[model samples]
Target chain A: MDVTNRIERALTEALSQADLAGCPPRLAAAMRSAVFPRGARVRPRLCHSVAAACGDDNPATEAAGAALELMHCASLVHDDLPCFDGADIRRGRPSVHKAFGEPLAVLTGDALIVLAFQTIARVNCAPDRLLKLTQVIGSAVGVPLGIVAGQAWECESEINLAHYHRSKTGALFVAATAAGAASAGADPEPWRMVGEKIGEAYQVADDLRDAAADEDEIGKPVGQDVAHDRPSAVREMGIDGAVYHLKSLVRGAVEAMPPCSNGNELRSLIMSEATRLVPAKLAQSAA
Target chain B: MDVTNRIERALTEALSQADLAGCPPRLAAAMRSAVFPRGARVRPRLCHSVAAACGDDNPATEAAGAALELMHCASLVHDDLPCFDGADIRRGRPSVHKAFGEPLAVLTGDALIVLAFQTIARVNCAPDRLLKLTQVIGSAVGVPLGIVAGQAWECESEINLAHYHRSKTGALFVAATAAGAASAGADPEPWRMVGEKIGEAYQVADDLRDAAADEDEIGKPVGQDVAHDRPSAVREMGIDGAVYHLKSLVRGAVEAMPPCSNGNELRSLIMSEATRLVPAKLAQSAA
Candidate 1:
């Protein structure tokens, strides 16, 4: 199966395991909806591509990719809660909290996080490698310098925009690359740069979209950066400046690709994804 | 250090790691408050005791125990959210959501869960044992049959009380025992029963306190089962009957200890914990 299909199947199976005979119907249903009718599946695909570049297509790689996607999906669910962005729509559908109520939404996010780790645990791999994969992913998901710290930045009255953006948006992207490498028994440290650049570009794109796109175009609330007083490239720099920065980060991602047998293929993948990350709409808005 | 002190030191270190210079102050504070002044710390203690019984008093076992406590603490924070039980106080203080605001509370819970796995991954053990430790704890925290499922039971209109209680409360206890055993290179399966019985007894004790004790006595709101219409042993079988069940479960925990060189010591530990689990207050209330 293709990477997206594999991720979808893995996610579906994970949710099914939670939806056993006496499982709460709404919680089970929300878990499925939170992951399915998916988003871009960017992180998982990036992970898979990196693993392929490293010359291993093992279950560890697939599992790592799927787990990364699950964590991404989980972040979205929690981010949309009333206490956070309070977004009522996600990927053009009712948000988990909106559809199933806030309690179920909270539970769904928690369950998905657990499922991510559980999925990684089940993968067939060298135990040391598996432990490394878990650490890389776990650090990206948690605090200090992870996505959780990124979101927590909003709670602060003052913040450094660069650090905030990296932790919130760049951490998982970094995790995806590092975990993919670790899963394939390659040096994970070099891949961190690849993830950081992609993640920075992705965050800039998100900022641009939030600043310029309509609710219909974005599939969720727009102008959230302004509404939430969040730190964003579009807010700190103008739309034009943000676009320029995003393109630079994209180039950085391509340049950061470590030497490997599949280096050229990975570069092309990164370039194609860069265009998607900073789409024409962003350019049009900046123009 | 004793288990409680060791667990506290480990947790303090974990939170400090997340409290980097630029980390959001409120998020950092909330994470600390969510775990400090912890309730009984039963899960971590159980885990440490089991690991000791299995003849491994290594850092890996300490890490596993701390991780379990972090997971348990995370659940408590989320469980007390406005959308769930909505309790204003936990462990005799303002709950995380109430003290730090809802957004911080949510983020605090998320960061702690991630911290749990990170702790285990950092353990100084053989790769396979660390992997097993992660799996054992992850399964207890996630869906199909973890604490997440336990909370999800409330969303369902109907639930088998036995399954609800087990998943909601017993799963973590089971993980504590199983993880402790795994950390020692011992077979983990045999230790599961010890956890289950202790967990079941703990739940019944909880139900008894919620049903019969005053708010001051329990350090939180009382009568929550009736208020939320949750499945409870005390509610299902009257307080007296529930007390009887608690005693029986305590006895089962004693009998369930697997044979080891430290069998006599472990049995004594279980009996002491059993008394604590079913305190004299429960007997007085039943009378």
Candidate 2:
């Protein structure tokens, strides 16, 4: 099956579990709204690619990829809350909070996080591998350096750009590679660099889009970094410098891929993603 | 070590992991404040008692208990948020949202939930047993019949008392008993009834206290059910009827315990807890 189908199917199965007979209908609806009409599916695709490159497409790997995407979706749901970004539109539709109300939105995000871990736990796999995957994925969404800490950085008076970006955007990407490798019973450590570089590149691309892309092009409001006064590559390094840095990170990601049985396919995936990351006008100008 | 000390130490270790370098100081502080100055620690005690009855003092069991406590704390933190209960105090102090603003409180709850799963994943245990424990614990916090569903029920226009009580309170109790058994490599199924009854009894007791006990006795606001027009045993059944129900449920819990070597010890613990559940004035009045 194709990567998108695998991720979508796994996600559907996982959400179905949460959408049991007794679940509150609104909460279930909100969770679905947050996830469906997918945006990019970058994290899960990376996870699946890494697992495939490791030469194993285990059911556990598919579940792990789905779990990563759910976590991403959960983060986005919470991120759009009034307390945070207060974004009204996501994936070109009303965001979870805007559509579901704040209370259900909060519950939806919480339910999704729980569902993410539950998805991994429900998958039948080697116990050791499941444990490792759970740890890697849990750490990506957790504290000290996880997405939670990344969000908390916004509240702090002083912020470190690298730490903020790493925790906010890079943690899940790191989890994607590591969990994919772990799901395949391989050493996940070697794959972390690839995730980190790709994650960094993605953030830079996001910063560039926020700075230069049209609102219609990104499907969400652009210039949010400026509006929110958030630290970003474009803000710190000028547009040209940020674009140059983004290209370097993409190259670094490709070079960092651990040699595996299906290395070429994975390499091509990363290169193609790089082309899509930068907005077309910026890509042309950089070229 | 005694059960209290064991729970405390495990929680300390878990929190320390989250309080790593580079974590936003306020976020870490908020997380700690949500957890420390602990409440009665009833859930962990129940979990430990069950583990002991099942003849296993495994580290995984301890971790499971701690994870349960963390989940409880996380729920309380979120429950007290402006969008939810909007209470200002918990455990005789300002609640997480009141103490550190709403944004930090949200992140703190999110972080704690992640920490709970991470704690269980980090523990060393038999792979199969760990897997079972993870599923049991994860289900207790997620949707359909978990605490999140319990909270979601409040959002719905209509609410079923049994479903609300089961998801909100009984689910974790069920998890405590089941996870304890699973951690000891025992079948978790037979332990469910004991948890269910105990959880129901506790909720009744809470209703009784809220209706009759003083604010000082509970260390937080009382009469919230009336204030919020929430469904409660006190409102549905009256104080005398609720007290009668509480006693019956406590008796049911004792009778439902699965036979094990340390059965008498667990029985005694349950009896003692029942005594503590009812406020002194209510107990005297009922008698």
What would the TM-scores of all predictions be? 0.95, 0.98
The positional error of residue B8 in candidate 1, measured at the CA in angstroms, is 2.7
What class would a CAPRI assessor give candidate 1's docking? medium
Give a tens-digit lDDT track for model 2, residues B124-239. Answer: 77777877877898889988889988898888878877788899989999998888888888889999999999989888888888888888888889999999998889899998
lDDT of 2 by residue, A142-216 (tens): 988889899898888888777898999999999999988999899999999999999999999999988998888
Residue ranges of candidate 1 with Cα displaced over 4 Å? A282-287, B278-281, B284-287
DockQ, computed on Cα atoms, for candidate 2: 0.81
Residue A173 shift from truth in candidate 2, angstroms: 0.8
lDDT of 1 by residue, B169-276 (tens): 999999998988888889999999999998998898888888877777768988888887777787789878988888888889988988865666666776676566
Could you tell me how far off, in angstroms, the CA of residue B184 lies in candidate 2 after the best superposition? 1.3
Model 2: per-residue Cα lDDT at residue A121 = 87
Predictions in order: lDDT: 0.84, 0.88
